[model samples]
Target chain A: DAGITQSPRHKVTETGTPVTLRCHQTENHRYMYWYRQDPGHGLRLIHYSYGVKDTDKGEVSDGYSVSRSKTEDFLLTLESATSSQTSVYFCAISELNTEAFFGQGTRLTVV
Target chain B: QQQVKQSPQSLIVQKGGIPIINCAYENTAFDYFPWYQQFPGKGPALLIAIRPDVSEKKEGRFTISFNKSAKQFSLHIMDSQPGDSATYFCAATHAGKSTFGDGTTLTVKP
Candidate 1:
């Protein structure tokens, strides 16, 4: 197992509230990714960071923001949560373009 | 547009039977193809991977068959076991970015 961990394993928030999911890695990998998994959508990348302070948007980046201040920490923030945004979030770490190691996942629900 | 497409959303087989999962991609730039396996309540884990330069790669009971000209790849599980029942995902990567297939659920009856 990779040294990746996602905080707040389960969370529930009201619509319009703010939510932030944290992904921490101890492996000191170069790349980190945030993804959301839905029933039919599978896993869609929300954002990813190649290095500290270097971030990029992915397939479903709308309404979500991410920041990577250090090599080990990547943060995903939802400025304003919505019911449609409810999904299981996963964080991945990779040393290069090869295989990625995923976290356990965070199950978030917005009501 | 989905770059990778996986078929037979679900599959069932008896123990010891081989199960194959197919995936297709339209992007010719994709050079890395990998398969992931996920059990309920867990994140997807790397099962095996293959590159376009290779026709096939085998690891343990898992094999990745790639057809670069057809822009397709498939996963073959030999001597499938009941414990092998899980969701399988095929992914393609080019220029360091990757796209994942929806996933195929495999059920192996003992």
Candidate 2:
């Protein structure tokens, strides 16, 4: 219920294509993150940005990339889409140790 | 290496029954444990959280029981209603970052 919104609630892309998902937050939280939610796997962190230009890799950051050039926008890009990379993507924002606020989630599929 | 492991892939309970979900972690460095609930087509929402220092935390019908020595924590829903049925995830934090376990799908039948 926070001010977080994800663009293109659903997307279907072919394999070996380029795709980018956007996450926008109005909360202006200091930390931003991207994660993929899959059945029996929960939510896995892909990439996160601690500041405008400071980003870090997560445990599942193999074929994903991220950029945070502004305070409210973070983008997750799939350089070359794969079948295994298809899942529900979520963007979350958190400040300090408070609960992280999440977007509605973007469901992506690769065919 | 998965730092957190959650059990009971799915669960079913009658209305007003209690539902319990367990989570265990391999790393003792994790200081923060939180539970989140998610509904279909929606994102995960914070339900409750607990620190290692406290053995238990309660908020409304949701309670978090933590055992530091055992390196485990759990969520218990008292008087769980059909509306409380959803996917529950347990997570742990490592230096400002968090990792989630495979969620438990709870279906409370009315």
Candidate 3:
């Protein structure tokens, strides 16, 4: 909520086109994460960055990629947008042991 | 295998009643457990959390029951109100990596 914001809060894109969702934070936390939310599936992690240039894949990493060139910003990109990739995406920031602060989320639609 | 398990995809409760959501984890390595509350068109927010050393933690009308031996935990909402209606998720983490439960949709009727 605080210090966390996601851009393109709502978006509609055509299939096969690339799209990027931006996560910006002022907290300067060490960890940033990207998660996708869907009906009946709750939230699924796509990727997370432990620090600038340090990233790892999550349970649902397929078709999604992330880059955290700066500590305060993390971006989730769809290599090639597909209808299956349409969902609400969340961005989170956190330190080693503290709670994660999540962004409001970006609702994406691909047709 | 799904590491975190939650039950009752959805629940409906009346005001003043208690809504209990259960979660079980397969990884004994998980040391930090937390529950999150999310409203419509919003990001999930942290509600209450518990460490493995403690058996229970209470804050306001929310309580987290931790059974370290059983590797199971639950969230109990006392004096449930209509405003408490939201999607609740249970999560556990180790080394800053987290796994989340499927989530429970609780609708507290007035």
Candidate 4:
């Protein structure tokens, strides 16, 4: 409902392969975040963008990278996929530090 | 280390029963606390939120009780229905950054 869309709702890749997920938003929010959800880890932040070309790493940033060239698009890339990286990834948008609206989610599996 | 800790990894209750989830945090800098609900195959959505300045905040049948001194907060669903069965997460925010609890899976039987 927040006008957020994540491309490649589901993906399966082999280990050592490259994978990238995209997040697009229409709310013109300044804050965009990428998170991964696992069985016991809950939602762990992967990366976040505060503005165009302004991004920061999160708690679980290892082996992952993110880039935001525009206000509406945020990208997360797995340089080399690993079995441990298999999880549901979520994209969220927020006007500020307040309430964040999340996308449906992207389920990725690495074998 | 986990910034926020949530209890009761899973719960089950009969329809029309009250279900409560508790969370504790060690960071006093956290000023905002929010609860999120997620159904199977869906992303988590905001259910309710509260600030440290307030002792309690309610939205419809959902309530957030906060105690700044105790560094804890809890979510209560009154007369919960089967539709309310879902995984719940509690999060703390500070300086635009947020830390979330592991999550609690709630099952409401009719």
Name the candidate that leads on lDDT: 4
* DockQ of model 3, rounded to 2 decimals: 0.73
**Top of the candidates by DockQ:** 4
**Candidate that beats the other on DockQ, 2 or 4, i.e. the better one:** 4
TM-score of chain A of 4: 0.98
Q: Cα deviation in Å at residue B92, candidate 4?
A: 0.4
Report the C-alpha lDDT of model 3 over A6-91, residue by residue, as the tens digit.
99899999999999999999987999999999998878889999999999999999999999999998999999999999899999
**Candidate 2 Cα misplacement greater than 4 A, ranges:** none
Q: What DockQ do you compute for every candidate structure? A: 0.77, 0.74, 0.73, 0.79
lDDT of 3 by residue, B1-110 (tens): 78999877899999999999999999998989989999998899999999999999999999999998889999999999999999999999888788899999999999
Off by over 4 Å in 4: none
For candidate 1, give the lDDT of residue B30: 87
* Chain A TM-score values, per prediction: 0.98, 0.98, 0.97, 0.98
CAPRI level of candidate 3:
medium
Q: Measured by TM-score, how close is model 2 to the native structure?
A: 0.97
> How well is each residue in A29-107 modelled by candidate 4, as lDDT tens digits?
9999999999988999999989999999999999999999999999999999999999999999986558989999999
Model 3, position B35, has a per-residue lDDT of 95
Please give, for residues B16-101, the per-residue lDDT of candidate 1 as tens digits: 99999999999998878989999999999999999899999999999999999899999999999999999999999876678999
TM-scores, one per candidate = 0.98, 0.97, 0.98, 0.98
